[model samples]
Target chain A: MIEIKNIIKSFNESTIVNNVSTTFLKGKTNLIIGQSGSGKTVLLKCLLGLHTPDSGEIIYDGVSNKKMNDSSKTLLRREMGMVFQGSALFDSMTVIENVMFPLTMLSDKNDEEIREKAEIAIQRVELEKAYDKLPSELSGGMQKRVAIARAIVMNPKYLFCDEPNSGLDPRTSIIIDKLIQEITKEFNITTIINSHDMNSVMEIGEKIIFLVDGEKNWEGTNKEIFKTTNQSVTDFVYSSELLKKVKKYL
Target chain B: MFYLSDIGKYFIMIKMSFFKPSKWKVLRKLIFKEINDLIIESIPIVAILSFFIGAVISIQTALNLSSPFISKSLIGFATRQSVILEFAPTFMSIIMAGKVGSYITSSIGTMRVTEQIDALEVMGINPLNYLVFPKIVALLFYPFVITISMFVAIFGGFLAMTFAGVPSEAYISGIQMEFEPYHIVYAYIKTFLFAIILATVPSYHGFYMKGGALEVGKASTLSFVWTSIIIIVVNFIITQLLLS
Candidate 1:
């Protein structure tokens, strides 16, 4: 579990994430939903240690981020995994090589053992046929799966996905969302997803935090989101006419 | 102020690149790949340019020394001085700043735009050590490239001189005339410094670049400009300190 305590981050004179505190529980898909320029990415970067908060603290399980030294942060990061929006697979490496990279760099295991572990991760993602294909040869959905396989190959305790469904079709997006949800539950990992996809929020958001202009506007479960009377939450959750009709039916 | 900050940042980047080294296995592979990319692949261009330029230098020197008072051996002497002191080391490096510098920038900038650098950082790897260190190490063999350029260029001069009806013996004797070993040392020193600049400056531009695909192109161009400027300035300084 990760506990965010009033985390505030700013760039230059502009504040991007302001006094936002929330708990992301283990074995659940915690989604941070916001419109464009609503600070979702900034907040995620703060959580990922890519951006340091100007104030407030983030505690990973029991250890405070501010208290950890560089080496400790590096060690903690080794137990973490990330899937970028672009599915940032190394362009030159084959799928199996991409999945095996972290192990090749960090693991003390032999080559055969590393290969076996990578194969298991690839099989978990059902990408066995793409083992030798480069990322450019893969489709959008396949690349996302490769990214997921690479992320989980190390058996990370924390998984972060930045807009994992972006650039994917609705059907492929749903599959990616379900895969992430299933993996989170199976591994009992603290999975935090930054997304604005309403379908993702409703389908897999066990806990949701809605941000408006860098501050938390509402927090609830997927079921509770429909019933919430908060104007900002309702306006965002039912922004589309189709979603408005769905909310009416609900 | 912008330049000052960038200079400071460049030093910090250089310092960080040597910190927390990668595993020997990973580093060995990266180093070898970089050697192939930055060093071995550069040989053909160096050889071709040196051969033609050396021929030109000998031809130009022979034409200018047409006076009956000037010895034919002076053509070889002038070619040797020009190629060793300036052409082979300094001029070839400037060309590399365009060829190799732009390549390093574009490749790294593309990775930045695509978030591969961020992926490495998120995985707890030092992206600088992984990306830049191997290039630096690989370019340590740059003097070897320069050495080849020197040999090929002088051979071109030899051929051109003989073809121009200067006796082979006169041209050979001229090449051996008043040869200072320190001049070769000075040339190699410049080669080594230029190699590091070639590796690092473009990397700095690419690694720190912002925005998308269009910006990657802009960064590559900008890196090339900065690398060439730094190379010329450093060459001037080295020449002043050593040759003066």
Candidate 2:
């Protein structure tokens, strides 16, 4: 589990994440949902240690991120996995090589052992045939799968994804969402996903945190999301006509 | 002030690149790959440019020395001095500031924009050591390339002088006359210095770059400009210190 306390991040006199605190539970798909400029990405970055919050503490498992030394922070980062928005696989490496990169760089495993683990991760993502192909050769969905394979190849304890469903087709988005959900359960890892996609929220958001203007507006599950009477949550969630109809039925 | 900040950042980046690598095996592979990409792949252009520049220098010297009292051997002497002292080491690096420098900037800038560097960072890999160290090691071959350029350039000068009816004996004697071996050593020293500049300046620009695809292009351009400027400035300083 990850706990954030009074996290406040500002840039050039403007606070991007303002006194937002939340807990992300283990073995569940935790989602951060907000429109652009609402600080979902910034809050996620703060959790990842990519951005430093002006105040408050991020407790990963039990250790405070701010209190750790450089070596300790490095060790902590090694235990974390992140999937970038663009599926940022090394363009020069093949799919399998991309998956094997962390193992080669950080693990003491021999070549054969590394290759075996990489192959298993690739297969886990159902991308067996793409092992030899470059990222550019794969479709968007396949690239995301390759990114997912790379992230899990290290067997991280915490997994964070930034907009895993963006730019993907609806069907592929659902597949990726389910894959992340299954992986979370299988590994019992603390997983946090940042997205503005409502379909994804309803599909796999076992726990969701809604943000408005850098502050938490609501926190609930998918079922609770439908019943919430918060005006801003309703305004954002029911902005679409299809979701409005779905809400009418709900 | 922007440049001052960049200089400070560049030094910090160089300092960071000296950290212990995550894995020597991975870094070894990266070094070999970078040598192939940055050195071997660049041979053809360097060779072609060096040869042509040598020929032009020989012909131009011969023309300028048209006075009957001037010795024809001076054509070869002038070509040798110019090629070794400035052309092969300094001028060629300026060209590389365009060729290899822009490539380094754009490649790393693309990685920055693509979030590949972020991925490395997330995995507990120092992007500086992972990305810049290999290029720095690969450019250890920069002096090697310059040595080849010097040889080919002098040979091309010999060919051009003889083909243009300058007396072969005089030209050969001119090249041999007053040939200081230390000049070659000085040139190599300059080449090594230029190599560091070539690897680091562009890398600093690329690694710290912000924004998207358009910014990548802009960073490449800026990298070339800064690299060329620094190379020339260093050349003047080295010449004053070593030769004066």
Error of 2 at A86 (Å): 0.4
Residue range B90-131, candidate 2, lDDT tens digits: 999999999999999999999999999999999999999999
User: Clash pairs of candidate 1?
Assistant: none
| Ten-residue stretch with the least lDDT total in model 2 chain B | B18-27
Winner by lDDT: 1
Q: lDDT score, residue B17, model 2?
A: 91
lDDT, each prediction? 0.94, 0.93
Encode model 1's per-residue lDDT on A1-250: one tens digit a residue: 9999999998888999999999999999999999999999999988889888999999999999989999999998899999999999999999999999999999999999999999999999999999999999999999999999999999999999999999999999999999999999999999999999999998999999999999999999999998999999989988999988886777
Per residue, candidate 1 scores C-alpha lDDT tens digits across B1-244 of: 9999999999998889999888998999999998999889999999999999999999999989989999989988999999999998889998998888999999999999999999999999999999999989999999999999999999999998878888999999999999999999999999999999999999999999999999999999999899989999999999999999
**What TM-score does chain A of model 1 get?**
0.99
